[model samples]
Target chain A: MDERQLKRLLTEIAHEEIPDDMNVWHEIRQQVETANSRTTRRGFRLVRTGLLAALFVLATAVAYAVYQGLIGSDPGLDAVNQANLVTTIEETQELGGDYDWAVTLHYAYADANRITVGYTVTGAAPARDQLRPFTNTLLRDSTGRQYTWLPVGGGGGGGGGGSSDPDALVPFEDNIGASFDASIIDDAPESLDLTLTIQLAYATEDARQEFGPDVMLPAGDVTFEFTVPFIAGHRYDGPQTASASAIDMTLQDVVVAPSLTRLDLCFAAPPSDNGKPWAAFADVTVDGNVVVEDFQLLSPIVPVADSDCQQYVMPLSLVEYVESGEWTLTIAALRAPDTESPDTVIQRMRDEAGINITPLEDGGYMFSEPLPEDMTAASAALADILSEEQQTLEGPWVFQWRFE
Target chain B: MASLVERYQVHAARVAYLITQDRSQAEDVVQAAFLRAYRSIDGFDPRRPFQPWFMRIVVNQALQTVQRDRRELSLDGDRQAGDPSFMLHDPGPTLESIAEQTELKQQVRQALKALAPEERAAVVMRYYLDFTEREIAAALERPAGTVKWRLHEARKQLRTLLGETEAEEG
Candidate 1:
């Protein structure tokens, strides 16, 4: 067939396959409205905070005490509270049915970049090989923009079994408490009127086992609407420059929020005669306490839009409230990716570490078996090589800022 | 925004469906792409046409979803069960012309199934979306030369899969 005929045929197939009635604007609108509401409420809160602070202090304290249970055992939420950045969300809903299920929205913390919400699900565990409780959450602001929950570790959802069996049912806990973190893409408002919708459905283990279509329980959605005032943070936009190992680096922006700290650093690209990719790494400390953990030096290196220098945004999650004191970001080293190919890396791991690594089709490597306890160090070294941290230029190029 | 969705949803969904070969997933990819476009509208330059930027998001999201589904399938160790080509839309109406059209669609679907997702995307953009090679490159974030190569390879594969020789250019 000619190009024209193929085009006509493809168009016809598409038109026939996708009906004209298919529209997803309703879903889009739901998410958009939630996001917009947060912006509006944040503006409103900023305008009213000065006038209402004195009158609301006592009432807010009492509410805080009542809602303190919701933030149970989450280090991040506890840090937000310690930083005085948390807003209590004392709302609960009952799923009124055969199963006495209840959901509570405990508390929320929002900074300029991220929002974290703690919640709890109190219900009976599902009977083995029967129905299982499935909880889906949708978070939105007053205006209707939805925020996707950040996956903790590699997977999303609060709790699930790690069994490899297809028929293995995840044993549900009576009181399942979890926290959801979502990064705000747009500029976060000073105050947000957030609405979180939690829908509960009981899914069967398998359709083939049940010999029928999957069933959805009659339990409806439980929604909690609350206002969370963002904890004030500091932003340093002045150019802070330091040079080490003949490489000049500048700290363009540093935003220290209750939720997280973000650093924007610009540096001159190291000479690459061999066409190898290089990246920068930093060690951040607040009052002599190291704040950055598991700093992945490679991946996500973006070039500054209007400048020759490359920029990287490093987000650090503080486990504890950062006290008002000295803060330092030391550009410790510049590292380049390993010059060897994937095959070479795999071969080296097998030869030196005696670890069999399989390269997946998606450009990732997997261990053939779980590493022995003694092999963890070797595995870490292998990871560094795979991540391309071969050559290194060491420097303690430091940039300091005071938060008071 | 509604008007924009109305104008682009069918084509965007069609491209996503053609690439992913799953109706429900295509719908989801289109919705997510529209939401992303809406959220990032402030970053968009007004002087440029919106279609390419929006289409780029749809294509990228579709590609990511396909990759993620593949990863999940690999982890689950049941690769054959969730193959998406089997989940193409229902057959068309029973009239003579409609039956012929349905047969043609089946042939096209089978032919498309032979190409990789990236090749399918390139072909859809080039033929159905009428995107130029440069435009396709910009949308896919690949070099123009790479886009040309993909299109050439995809057309050759499709010709072989569909069992038809190229006719003279109009």
Candidate 2:
């Protein structure tokens, strides 16, 4: 078209006016103004500072984030202390008896909050020949600055033990630890230097002479004054050796009827070569008499030779399987078929010769299986097995749960 | 509302002058831009150098105003209607050519108004103001690609507008 017209149009386009009103700009500017004015960690935006300054600022922000990242692992877990553990134990002993003993154990499994303790009281330990099942009243308590608890119950267990005779011979293997809870005196005068005195209210002189002075009473009550360093943390793991109880039964005989079942363990070498039994023989004593005089652990419980006789058959020993690197570790508790008593039968046996015959509840024992003589050689083997296989007991449970 | 006097009016005026052909409208656009700038001061980054930033704001402000007022922006509109000389062209030197040239100046004013705000802004900043692509981006708070595309598009639109005007006169 006309070049003259194009030039004129271009000239006209150049002169346009801007209006005066629109204002929200001031508010937006102020938001950024404060951050810019301070001598902030974020340095000044240089005059054409280039990409370098911006990159540096970004780097600094990332570095600070990384440093804080590595340092926050145990923020709230460190709050648990020794005092809270002790106070918890001291608060729950003897149903407020004037001379009650409170024992609190503060242990950590991942430093989590709360610890539980269960305590049981039974009539008495059964004598060696008599299969009197031990009666247990279990109570549990939580360990903390404050002690909370559940009431006592008679029957329930991870496992239980019993016998045919009224006097059931109790062994350390059958022994159940202090219950999860205890009935304690809230106002009992506490002892920093505490002495927990336990007396046998109605135990025979024979039992007292055999176990401890605490066995002298009608019913033996073992009062444990957890030594000043008696700190109980972690759950009560039912390993006889793993958990140690300090008792003041010095003059009195000390018999711990913990229904412990020793595993059938053997050295890779023969008994003669290792100069030891497959397992050490342990004297299973009840109220006062030894129930299992001394039994040798021949082998770990494996498949039954005849599953047909499962009703009354003994179990294979865990000792044998452990030595062989394999064995069935099933521990079942069954109540006595004859009597409706709380006692159950727990058999630890293998398909092979060695069978560990023990009761799980408060009654009934099959008298057909005779007791073995000084199986001390087996005890020696068991001691080694304990050293090698102790970690096994650190898990699950070796004791019975107290069901109402 | 307190008489929006721009703290950076001078720089804004310079920006308007560089982009616009009419000095009078440049002054007016700059003032409007300053009023907008003054109102937006609170939103401004005080840490930044105020001049370039304010220039960017003024350019956008003026472009928008031009787009909104087309009659005030053009050349031929001002000449009286029905006057044959005002409408026609003389192939030689004549009173109509002189009047038409004055009308051309007026047309320039109007053409600015005719442009879409963004194109007017690009043409104003790119050619009239001679600002580099990077500076225009900062002013528009846009990427360089966006600024370049806008400038290209504005130039094409202006060329077409100019072509139409030439065709009308011929």
Candidate 3:
């Protein structure tokens, strides 16, 4: 008989006989009844004893909490981060004081090799440096402006905190477009020592006092450590096996559809890393125009100090979706001190952002098509949730590109 | 005032039957399940019906055991629960031959494992113990329509697993 018939027969549930082995339940029942009988015989005495015992326990617990709270037991994530205190505070409960913030890290989201740290500041100006793995440092001001500490000829080999050349810290884009999908997260251990410093404080009156990132604390540079949860796909030990060969940007397969709007972008990371593992992030574009860019990704999901870090492979984002296209993802090459050469970055970006999104009449994206007519009931029930979301967007779009 | 174990005794075998797919595993699962049931009986609602609630706990524990064992099988809703369908259809050599005797039954057991977790559960509750679909849905915290769909898919998959034709699966 087929599995269906077989399962039909097996779904029949039946009860069990009392085991001849051990009757733990039987003994437990007897013990409970004995306890109950004892209570009935000396009811008042038993109640008084129980109440006294409970009070003693509650008093002990409250005393312990009071001691801890006085010594600043567990500071909030914000306070610990701002204080930058490496050691636990015994006198003050605020972990991160007004200047430096430190925290007990629990997880990381980067691949094992590159530590990714995220931090915000109270004031806009401060001096910052990563302690180990590399001593990379930078400076920022009250307006959230970032400066790259360029060591004349320093960005060599081990990178970041490695070089100690004549320094000329130049103004760099303080905020890079970093979009990550933590929709599917898992536990992967890693961390970054986040240090945010706001300098140039004496220049403005408000800068002297009102400068926390997003109006939180006050004005000034603050350094702290915040932990991030890991994303499963990015974790790797040493290197990646080139599961898919790297694509040459010059010969990228371009699909041209004219009427498409709304594009869904994703990155396919190389399974592992070799330092040569091509997990690079970049800005995406169509026809020489920038639709999306700055994909900074940290692998393995989270990063903690004194532990390994995750690398940012290809950071993918929806480049600007129109209804259709004969679109060319103009691979822009970057000439930077902290990124891969532009051409290679573009090629890596294209491979990960597989251009196989379904262009539809509603301009919204669907990961699947109606199951081929061959499989069993292909019922509309399967289409339930997807069709529900599709009904929201108004108007229709067309696609000139024959998606073959 | 009655002990918890005594109250759920009648449904024990039925609960074990659906979960382990084997009388031995089912028996063990039920006994352990009851011990756990007793330890946490304070949480029991005095107002609700006990059978479905007990079955949910028993079935959940059984399914977890199966998962731990990595048993792959199917969930079929059509097979008549009480009938010994295997013995009637596949009569082979020696009744002494494990293959001829219990093989078909075991295959039936394993086939049941292939169904999606919920669908298999549905089939077990509905056909095996003859609980209605509504009761199965309530036990699972799922809607009746979703339950029907899961059952339909499970049955379809099982038909393929069991080598049944269109009429049997449909």
DockQ of each: 0.13, 0.02, 0.06
Candidate numbers sorted by DockQ from highest down: 1, 3, 2
Q: Candidate 3, which CAPRI tier?
A: incorrect
**Chain A TM-score, each candidate:** 0.51, 0.17, 0.18
Q: What docking class should model 1 receive?
A: incorrect
Error of 1 at A347 (Å): 3.8
| Sequence-dependent TM-score of model 3 | 0.26
TM-score for all models, in order of appearance: 0.40, 0.23, 0.26
Score chain B of each candidate by TM-score. 0.73, 0.53, 0.60
Task: For model 2, state the Cα shift of residue B170 in Å.
Answer: 1.4
Candidate 3 lDDT for residue B157:
54
Using DockQ, give the best candidate's number: 1
Lowest lDDT sum, 10 consecutive residues, model 3 chain A, at: A150-159
- lDDT of each prediction vs. the true structure? 0.57, 0.32, 0.32
Comparing candidate 1 with candidate 3, which one achieves the higher lDDT? 1
